[model samples]
Target: MTNVKLLLSAHRRFNDLLSALALSADIQPFLAKVIAAVEEFLPDSKVTILILNQETNTLHSGAKNNLPDFYNEAIEGVEIGASIGSCGAAAYLNKTVIVENINSHPNWHSLLPLTQKANLHSCWAVPICNSSNDVIGTFAIYHHQPKTPTAVEHEIVNVAALITSVAIEKRELEEKLRFNASHDELTGLFNRAYLNNVGDSFISLCIRNNLNCSILFLDLNKFKRVNDVFGHKRGDKLLCQIANIIQQQTRSSDIAVRFGGDEFIIIMENSNDLDGEKVARRIHQLILESVSNEILALDFGVSIGVAMLNNKPQSLSQLISRADQAMYIAKRSNLGIYCKP
Candidate 1:
């Protein structure tokens, strides 16, 4: 009956972790809940979840409990090797691994120098993986004195790994979904949806505060000829190149979004007519310089239109329409220049 209740409690704890993860956009909240759940479910257990830093070959603390500062710092990470420790060996071997008695295990021998400070007796680690089964991190429990986990203890660790694995997978999926929603896949620039959602908020805030707001509408000149002549592949490459230049020229606070096919927009904060016109002109000059002549037998330039707020427009659509009209006028005069709206 006691074991049955423990299983029920473990099930409830896992659901709690998932619920917390779903509510918070950041990973920290989920980690905190996970640590709490582990404490509740596994009494007197020392737990640590170490996540791999692929770039640095180091491990980061996802969670930790009841470990001294010296031990925490000492055994945080080791190079992936068979003799490095249970974790290093598990990661290196790419499987669930253990060092039952740190004193005598071949794998724990090299890690002894570090583990001696913490005096870890027995440790077991299980690789946490996503739905795709790619290793993301590890779930570990350590004993202060030499002992192997009971069947029930190992089951609890397994449950923790399952919960963590699913959380990691869901978070990654959410990030990818967000990226797709807000950015252009081909040119890797902000998308129209992002402009409508986030860009409008900036404009609204500036208007409420009686501050400056500006928007630039730009169109690529003769972009169709390039797509027709050099093929869409080279036309796509040129667009990416142009987008990169625009990103570099725009201030960090400014928002740049690809409005749609062959067109882009920028929302500049605290920019008056003069400031707005200058940014538009700069982007125009940059495009002219970047593709000065035909590359792969194609020529390209851009027409820019600037709309600055002495007072913010009644709506985003109103500002965008004014800029669009200005772009049409600039397109008529010069292929690459900015016109005030």
Candidate 2:
């Protein structure tokens, strides 16, 4: 093909690949297709995509084409630094990194053995950034022979990186929206909507596995009085404190939900009524101590009701209703109590 024709063909392929990536719901398959497209455009090069993990400050392999498994393993989770390999440095600097001769480059000193084993001699990487210009990943093309990327090859890498950034940002925003929909804004606990949506499935799972599960329903005592006297700000703070205490008292398997107003629910998997009561008591004790010590001796307490799955053997709504009724009983008694249903 003529040079102009080749350029036109590459642009068409790039557009087609970007369209496919944009419509993909999952990142893995999108990345796989991206690397494949890169390999097709640069037949002599191996393409790999690495995504930045902010929590670990490392680059993780997202996709690879024409690369050995051992080479991929060697570069996985590589910490980003000034002296790290092309992808790591590009991600850290938020810019393109071109290493024409990997064998002689100081940046690839640590990765030289792996690259030599894989017969890779050159690497060019472009940093992938989101709309906010935050670098999220790297798109790298490695050559078996020592050579710098041609102008057209550089254009292709840059466009691929841009496409990747758009896809990642879109996915992240979708995840954030989903999280906000199901979580309480104040206490960061699962909201009532989330609890209602999953409660039935959780109950069915417990029943099918013949496992014991319990629900602890909690209601803050005289919470309106606190808001009236202490202002809504203080009341909000107190609720947050209570939520933290409940979370601390519950196990990792428990699903804690802020079930509207001053009410909360905890679904304890593989737990009996006794276990639910223990958690309730611990939460009450912690709240009493926290409110007394931190909030100027304010009168804050919770009335808890415990219900076991085996005891109820009914719908989740019935269990919650029984627990709610039990909570009212505890509230009327004016005692630090956990009633069973």
Candidate 3:
């Protein structure tokens, strides 16, 4: 009868963990709850989740329960290696690593000081793999006395690792989709949709803060001719190059967008006419130099128009119209850049 009650309780705990994992958008909080659930089933044990950073080839603590701050800090950013310790080795090998006795295990020799400080006597780690079967992290349990996991505990840890991998992969996919919707694929700059969605908010911010703001509208001169002569591939390369120049000349607070084909817009926050004109002149000069250098077989230039927000424009469309009108004037006068009169 007692065994039946214990099984029912463990089943309920796992069900709650699954519900939490399915509902949470973030991985850290889900992992924190996972450690708590594990503690409930297997008392007197500490749990931690470590994620592998591919760029650095290092492991970082993603979540933990009942572990000392000093211990976490010491093991943070641990480089993955065969002999580094249970979690590091499990991630490196893409397999489970069990150290029944921390004092005698050779893999834990260097990390003994940390375990001793935390009073941890043994550890078992399982690698968490994504849908592609690529190991992305590790789930580890540390006991207060020398021991190995029972069959039930081992099974529980494996299920937890699987759930963690699914949650992480889902979060990554959502982020990628969001980025794709907001950015231009060719130049990786914000697209017109993003500008259309956020323009009103930006104007409100400028008005509330009483800060100067300006916009620069630019169109590539004779871009159609270049596309016709050099082919579409080379035209795309040139546009990408121009995008880099615009990014370089703008401040971090500025919003640079690929407004449309052969057209770009720079929204300069906390900037006046002087600031906007300075950027326009720099862009004009860079385009002229690029053309003079004969980097490409054809002529390349840009006509720029600047609009200042000092007069407090009634709407974003009005400001954009003013800049567009100025651009046409610059084109008519054969001037590379012009400011609103």
Put down candidate 2 lDDT per residue, 1-341, tens digits, no spaces. 66566667777876886687667778777777777777877778888878899988899877655699888887789999877989989988988999999999999987888889999999999998988898888889999999898788888788878877877888898898899899898998899889889988888888888888878889987788788877999889988988888888877767899998999999887545488777778887777777854344445567888777774367889888878877887888866665664
Off by over 4 Å in 1: 1-44, 54-57, 69-84, 103-114, 149-155, 185-188, 198-200, 207-210, 226-237, 270-273, 285-296, 311-314
Our tally of clashes for model 3 stands at 0
TM-score of each: 0.77, 0.87, 0.83
| Residues forming the 10-long window of minimal summed lDDT in candidate 3 | 290-299
Rank candidates by lDDT, best first: 3, 2, 1
Looking at model 1, the pairs that clash are: none
Compared with the true structure, all predictions reach lDDT values of: 0.77, 0.82, 0.84
Q: Output the better candidate (1/2) by lDDT.
A: 2
lDDT of 3 at 39: 80
- Which parts of model 3 are misplaced by more than 4 Å? 1-12, 26-28, 207-210, 221-241, 284-295, 310-312, 329-334
lDDT at residue 188 of model 1 (Cα atoms): 78
**Where is the poorest 10-residue window by lDDT in model 2?**
292-301
TM-score (C-alpha) between model 1 and the true structure: 0.77
| Comparing 1 and 3 on lDDT, the stronger one | 3
Q: Assess candidate 3 and give its TM-score to the true structure.
A: 0.83
lDDT by residue (tens digit), candidate 3, 1-341: 35456556766776776787677777777777778877877789888888899889799887766798999899899999888799989999999999999999999998888889899999999998889999888999999899998777787788778877878788888898899799888987889999889887787788788888888999988898787876899889888988888988888778889999999988888545498889889988886676634533455668999888875554677778888888988887889888996
